[model samples]
Target: MSATVGSALAWWARTQPEQTAIVVDGESLDYQGYEAWSSRVAVHLRDAGIVPGDRVGLLAENSLPWSAMALGIIKAGAVLVPLNSRFKPAELRKVADDAGLARVIASDAVVAVAREAAGMGAPYEVTAFADVVGLRDAEPDPATDAFRVDREPTDPIAVLFTSGSTGRSKGVVLTNQSLLSIVFEASLTEEGFRQGSTSLLVLPLAFTPGLVWGVLMTTVLGGTIVIEKDLVPGRAVRLMEEHRVQAVFGVPLIFDAFSRTPEFAEADLSSLRTAIVGGAAVPVPLLEAYAAKGVTLRQIYGMTEAGGVATATLRHEAKDHPATCGYGSIFTELKIVDADGQEVGPDEEGEILIKGPGVTPGYWGDPETTAEVITADGWLRSGDIGRKDADGRIAFADRLKDLIITGGINVSPIEIERVLMGLDGVAEVSVIPAKDEKFGETPAAIITPSSPDLTAADVVAHCEQQLSDYKVPRYVVLREDPLPRLPSGKIAKPQIKQDYADVHVDFDKVR
Candidate 1:
């Protein structure tokens, strides 16, 4: 057994076979159970001719099967490409084609969607692993006898999709050692990630926090993870209470939804000792609310290329600097750099550059784009705006990409602007982030109409032709003035964003 997840699982199964490894919808699978199930899946993959280094697709909603299927893919020594369950045919096709998947293992819940996506010209095969959890009954001679392919640490394990600044999804190639490095670091940390801890994960298992931090990190520590397929506010609260979850992870929106629930005040959340929140800045009120319950909700700032965690609010600074992402982790080195790439002094805002063991090697199959983001000397240009305080704590300023993260998903405004500009009467269009009660923030399009008659309906209709639904602006404002520009000739997004703050458009009234 090597220093991989598969080896870790084997160690755990041998040491504590009866320990509860995963729980979903009231059913629990012990370490031995999931190990045996994943073994059978590995054997099934081998029988189907999936060789080492081949990329296999794992498409399913968060569930016990998803966990097993992912482990099986790893054990088979094949690369895993975890597709987002919410993707439509076009997005699915894009990922499948990009990954050049050897096969896709979709659970029964989304087997039909997978089949439809496969038929839409994704070469290779799609296996409908009916009753994925029932794979344990495949009746292998013994769990110990299951075949395990030794994988090199340098071998690529997963290609997680990220919405790049260029609009298309960039498959971040993470090596086995890259992931293990972070997981191994978490195991030794005193940040509430410990053995026998029960973690509740509500976010999607496709990327960052969900897979690397939530599932993989938890498994490495031999902890039990509670997985919920979809996050219905009430159900999520009850699920956490029912499981007596020790640690919880999600974005700020997840916490906001829980706070909105009437039961939040009295939800018996005493079991929640450590609350990890990320994605967006934590509102002071939200932090106070959790603090009142004796739960210190720490904020983390990271990206897909940083192995899911870069800087996290240290335990001592958790309550004081509730807004800042925090000091850099021992495994990652963080710095603020000026436009010319020189290191900036304290409290000076500049691009955040990170370099460490957690930083990814590069993006999959695209050396040109990878070279642009990752410097030749091994530093990753985060494309995010931030600054460091005198105390060495990192605080987020803004995004260099001008990205709108609505509902915790990145929406490229440039993609939408291109579509809106394509329509008649649209001279110039700038998409800015607007505050939303549900999603925290959504896209708002400010247009300078060129033609005599240009309707908001026309703009939205044109956007519908190209962009995804979430990327479409919920509010459209037609302006007679030119869009503000900086001295550098770039669109002054801060001004547009500030002006749009007070003006809220009702989406329901929009045509």
Candidate 2:
């Protein structure tokens, strides 16, 4: 068995050296090329004084070299810290100070930014992007003989930073087993993912979903990972068509863009057989838009703590039960429990807890916080409120912290948002709690119109047809701009809540 990240890639290197491993920007690298290039990077890190258990930071735009650098760090027995590509100097400094990074490799555009962050307070080495990827077999390093893969499956291989939606961000520690085992077990059961499959990807590889799940999973099977240079709608479609990509993975927004692009209507998407759409609640209109093109959008649910993906809707099951994130994967087990910690019955709402091989041991260097989330019995508290049906299909409610209490009644903003999305002329909607004089708190929504004539009254009338009295959104704000989004591409709920926390809508206007 492959006990470490380097060994994981080494397994494929020995078995199928000539098989294409990654397809980046119209260029291809077979398993042999992957092994050679990654090994060269390992030698570079060794020359730079990296050691086992030391944290090395990666900061660069998503590209072939960026992925190889990550593997190189692992092969040299160092833990990788993937710095966010969108992070400014201050934000970058915080993580560098926290992780105590030994060195950071960055692109040309980011060299000054990374150096500025280090100049403020951090003392880590900031290596230019060229030095990391400039290696070749022309003049081999004598220190290459000293480099060895010595880490175990349980040892920390990476420290992934969360999206920081809930105040300060926490770094989630992951192991080789916590990551490699997920895709290994998944391919054994999922027909859509196998040794020869080809998947197109666009999300930044610095994040867990893009790197650990999408990149690592595809590479393990000797499959092709077609990395999109950018998220331009027309460009993504052209690459997918030319590469004959069989599967796709991204947040719902990326898929929605493809469906809306003028070229997508006539694009040769016959090669696409499966897709993963998550990172936020997917509206039915988004699903139907893809269905018309013979594609079924599978719902996926997971977090940074679970080592990337916990559950995914099968390609065949997405059509009938669109809301289901599907039963837990073979390596993961899901349970919904009430506040008292007792497991709830089918369809009974409660907090979601996960336990499995894919679960992380804990957050990096924060035992107190880790203990609060991970119970004594070993189940990891997901903090998401949801329910599982009798058949084991899971449906999300809302974040436990996001639940609104008005007149002592718990209100799920997600439920109301779903109903609002079903209404015509509503392009996008986010529901938040608005302070009410009489009720304490009432539901408020900010909506982007699908048509120019969409009105607050039109939204209220549609809610009346579907929701109960209290569930209806009392404050409806219509706008032409898109909702604010986090770096991970998920909607910025905290920003939304902050923008409308004290704003009140007149009862007469909404009526």
Candidate 3:
């Protein structure tokens, strides 16, 4: 068998038939069981007229079936489009139309939302997740090899939509070769990403970090993945102890929340060997919090364009340069460049560029936008400002895109400002990131209202109806004076950011 994703699962089933592959909410699925389950789903999809190169939409919370369904789509040689569960109807409709989905598999919890979203887009078939996963008696005939399609290494396996800084979502097309390359390389270099290791996965599978690092990489290593739909702090600690989880991948907020749990003091975290934090800068207190529990919190840095992980701080190097994102991964190369596209010397702040096999080819159906970010020679403009030390370690400085990462989810300030600008009472609005001790950063709206009666409360209420829960402004500021502007007639965000540099949100009252 080839080194494609579907082949890896088949290989594992044949090699370790009874080995546990996944544990979801106390339910376990062995290698053979998972392979058979996914194969069955592929058969059903082929029966429903799905073929190679077709795009399939998966809308569901994290669950055992969701994992199987993801692999099943790959087995059937179709592209999997994982939709965010937090998306409202309009958002979903946009994604549905953009991906030109042929069929959508939705869980019972979000089936109604899927219907409403699909109703607004081009007509497509919607199947309940239960109906597809429950095809135990409808096995495919062995003569046709269960209708499994063979995929080449370069065949697109999944199209992940990353929320752009410009408020438009871009679908990044990822190939089987790209995903498998990262999986194999990281297994050798990334500590705790080893065979038989158990990892606690709390991030939603829809996101890049969760799907790539938590699922694909773990599966390729024949490791066990413990999926948690929601992050109940106490339950997460208990689950880690119960599963003897060796690896935990999440953002700073997750570790911060875990430290505050009552079980933190007496929790048996002895099993934890690799705890990696990303999505935001890891606070020193958060690293010390995990350190006290006998776990080291290593930092990782990457984006959806880099296939989830481009650089990671290894165990041996974590203590020396605790703040850096460490050296590039096995197959990744990193460089910092100035505005003139010239490589800067060590310790110089510039835009980070990545070149590697795991790097995305380009955005789906948007060649012009793709050319803007990725150079012709294959280097990707990360849009993140950072500096590389003499030792080749990368330290994050700031974002050129001005994206706000709240609770591990990327929020575009432009997206929120567009929504707020729709309000009749709002004349001009500028959204900036508010410092939060709990969530790292949250959206804060600073507005110069047209009407004197336009209050912060009204702004929040208007946003509640348009944006997702995490995208809503946690801190609102109403100013009587006009916001500072630049010569180009754009909002002077740098000046505004400096003005509110000390502004912090009380998460207890807002959340």
Please report the candidate that would top TM-score against the real structure.
Answer: 2
Candidate 2 RMSD to the correct structure? 2.5
Cα misplacement distance, residue 187 of candidate 3 (Å): 0.9
**Model 3 global lDDT (CA atoms, 0 to 1):** 0.81
Q: How close is candidate 2 to the true structure, as a TM-score?
A: 0.93
Off by over 4 Å in 2: 136-148, 505-511
Residues 1-511 of candidate 3: C-alpha lDDT, one tens digit per residue: 3878778787787899899888888888888777777888887789999999899988998888888888888888899999887677788888888888998889999988888888886877888987976754354445333335778888789999974433457999889889987777777775577877889988888878767877787778888999887888899999899889999887665787899999887899999978988765666666778788888889988888998778888777776676799878777999999999999999987999999989998888889989999999999999888899998899876577688998888787767886887787876778899888789899988889989898777888889999898999988888889887532123667778878776673322243
Model 2, position 148: C-alpha lDDT score: 53
Q: Encode model 1's per-residue lDDT on 256-363: one tens digit a residue.
A: 788778777778888886787765567677788888877888888788888877878886778888768777887788999999999999998899998888788888
Q: Every model's Cα RMSD, please?
A: 10.6, 2.5, 10.7
Candidate 1 vs. truth: CA RMSD?
Answer: 10.6
**Candidate 2 structure quality by residue, lDDT tens digits, 1-511:** 3566576577677788788888777677877667777778877787889888889898987787777778878777888999887789999999998888988888887988889898889588888877766663435444452235768778998898898766568889988877777777667655367777888878888988677766777766777888865789888888788888888878888898988888888888788877787777777778888888887788988888986668878777887888889898886889999989999999999999988887888988889999999999889998999999889998878888877788779899888888987888887788888887788888887898888899888888889898888888888889799888876778788888887666574333274
Q: Which pairs of residues clash in candidate 2, taking residues 3 or more apart in a chain or in different chains?
A: none
Stronger candidate by lDDT (2 vs 3): 3
- Candidate 1 deviant stretches above 4 angstroms: 131-133, 143-145, 163-166, 403-511
lDDT sort, best first = 3, 2, 1
Model 3: residue 166 alpha-carbon error in angstroms = 5.7
